[model samples]
Target: MSDGATTRVVIIGGGFAGINAAKVLARDRRIAVTLIDRSNHHLFQPLLYQVAMAGLSPADIAVPIRGLLSRFRKVSVVQDTVTGIDLEAKQVSATGQSWSYDYLVVATGARHAYFGHDEWESNAPGLKTLSQATEIRRRVLQAFESAENEEDPEVRKELLTFAIVGGGPTGVELAGAIAELSRSTLTKDFRRIDPRRTRVVLIEAGPQILAAFSAASAVRATRDLEELGAQVWTESLVTDVSEDSITIGNDGEKLRTRTVLWAAGVHASELGSALSGELDRQGRVPVGADLSVAGHPEVFALGDLARTEDDSGAVLPGVAPVAMQAGRYVGRLIRAELAGKERRPFRYVDKGQMATIGRSKAVVETGRLRLGGFLAWAAWLLIHIYYLSSFRNRALVLVQWAWSYVTFGRGARLIVDREWRNPET
Candidate 1:
């Protein structure tokens, strides 16, 4: 597949956008693609909360990048951390190497933002990566383990309380899963502390949870969460997050809890700043209608890192579908150029949005089709399962879900981390 005369395409960050871009570009024999990422695998980020809550293993939601690209003869996978970019030279500099490219695709994605309080990151862990999910899982399960041996009732109560910052999908899912995990999974497992009594608080500065969703859906989700025993606190700003607790509001209403999971906000990945371009407040680079960087048409920015508005002037939301579609468009554009075909502007098709609260509880929005409760939940499950990269993962996840549903027990509940060794001490 090596044509002596070929276009060198370098894609950074093997996330949804990068992967999709590479897949599409691989079809062109004249395009030699190199995909680089810090991580070796492509993660299904939507299901990362399940991993954090011990409902799914890391392997269940991730596929190796090398394996994914093995079929594509022209595409090479590189495992390296991209440090910076040399736009003038048209090359990407990683930790140990630098590669020149005829065209570049930046899909580095975003990371958890603590709203200028970077110090809070240590106190309240965010669920963005597999390691963070495992760490949260460790802290969550260890809290119960330490509470079982704790003598002081107040200390035990503090250990039992789980506070989550942000009321978005991640926060809501975590709150619901924590509540269900306490009431169902760990009910008979713990002898000293009744997991059912575990306090789960979801703190949101916004007026409603899932602010992107319909207000009706938000109300329904709030009710469902409350029914599961999670305290949903809206218009509550977290001022400070200390090791033992988090302080909320100007009134400094402190909630003492050992575990704090952050799902608050995210800023674009640092890679966006590598190029000399205008960045939005959220650090996203503004791309053209074709998803190309301004003044640098050969350079493309995809996924959460790129900011583009629709025809109605509403900016596209940072979701998987948007990224995938953008990647596909860029790929087609590049191919069209190579083939001397006319290129068209990229357009995002607004597919419906869905979020699951807990078992048999979810919300779905698709044009005029609004679904909730068991129907939405089932749809959520099937959609996620279908999107999984491999058939093996789909089968494994389905089996795990079935087992967890039947027995009300989480299969991946093992707390395997060094921090758990003497967490309370």
Candidate 2:
């Protein structure tokens, strides 16, 4: 609005998709871009668990948005929550202020869903944002320090046990990292309770863990998890969660763990549901082949929030590559529109999927190639570092990973907050 000649483009998220879009759009001098996010920095979500486990710092995985676009005079970043959009006026309302835009992009991402039992969220938390990761980090380290001094064996055991309520990549990675923290790093720290005796249980309602992967890969991951002394409870469902214990389905099994990480499922953030458009049961707006919302050419949604089916009628999975590709595609489409040309439909370029299990163990599927174990782990590590935004982040992550690999130690282990009681009650 400040410049009469500049066409204002408002992006309502700063995650993978939004950041990439801004970076791409900054190339043009006529476009005025404003990126709005709740936080100042863009986060690398893939390695968030590493931050939670103290292997990486917040600065390592997060880069300040303004720092990224310092030289791009046409770009501006705002840390604010977008509350509403005026479709007719082509304006956005956020942080109690309104801004008009010629084009709008929604990339607000997703959050963990509690299904119908919303009250269960307090007891079981998920890792998503930077603050959530930091809280989990504090809780994880505090659990160890608490278990070190507790007198009652049952209480100490409860404090030591950890339950992860999903078997996906985030769940698997967190479980493995915590397991290593207990089995290897703290094996010699405590005298009262053997830290290696800490129990980590992964629960899933599906028939198998890593359901996204092939049956062979999932089965192998299950075996590897068990080999690492983590209890992989397939076909297990969580019926109830309390501060002290998790009730496991109709089955009588219960894990008395003070800490539970929710990685089971995620629903699109509030922005998606706010749109008066047709949406799936998961709250994602079903998009056409061109990745545009039906009937809305001025509005585009990307990242985990948009459900876009490919030519085969299969919806693309919510992954980093999908969002990044969608962002780049949308940026180009906007460019086409500016040039008085018709926009082309979007097509996702699948760069493959990979998940690391434990030390030197991973599964990767790229093109026709399927790899596992050490080779896959190396590939996964390289790919994550390469996609990171900052060269400093890449260097820091590489150094931290190298140190972790060599010493079997995690660095960002400081607990900045005190634990609160009655986590569920």
- Compare the candidates by lDDT and give the number of the best one: 1
- Ten residues in sequence with the least summed lDDT for candidate 2: 416-425
- Judged by lDDT against the true structure, how good is candidate 2? 0.83
RMSD of 1: 2.8
Score candidate 2 by TM-score against the native.
0.96
Worst 10 residues of 1 by lDDT: 416-425
Per-model TM against the reference: 0.97, 0.96
Estimate, for each residue in 1-425, the C-alpha lDDT of model 1 and write its tens digit. Answer: 22559999999989899999999999998899999998898988999999999999999988899998899998999998999898887989998899999899999999989999988888898887888888899889999999999999999999999999999989999999999999888999988889999999999999999999999999999999999999999999999999899999998899999999999999999889886467999999998788888888899999999898888778899899999898888888999998988768888999889889876789899998888888999999999988885535688799899889889888888989755221111
The Cα error of candidate 1 at residue 332, in Å, is: 1.2
Q: Give each model's whole-structure lDDT.
A: 0.90, 0.83
Q: Compare the candidates by TM-score and give the number of the best one.
A: 1
Error of 1 at 260 (Å): 0.5
Measured over all alpha carbons after superposition, the RMSD of each candidate to the real structure, in angstroms, is 2.8, 2.4
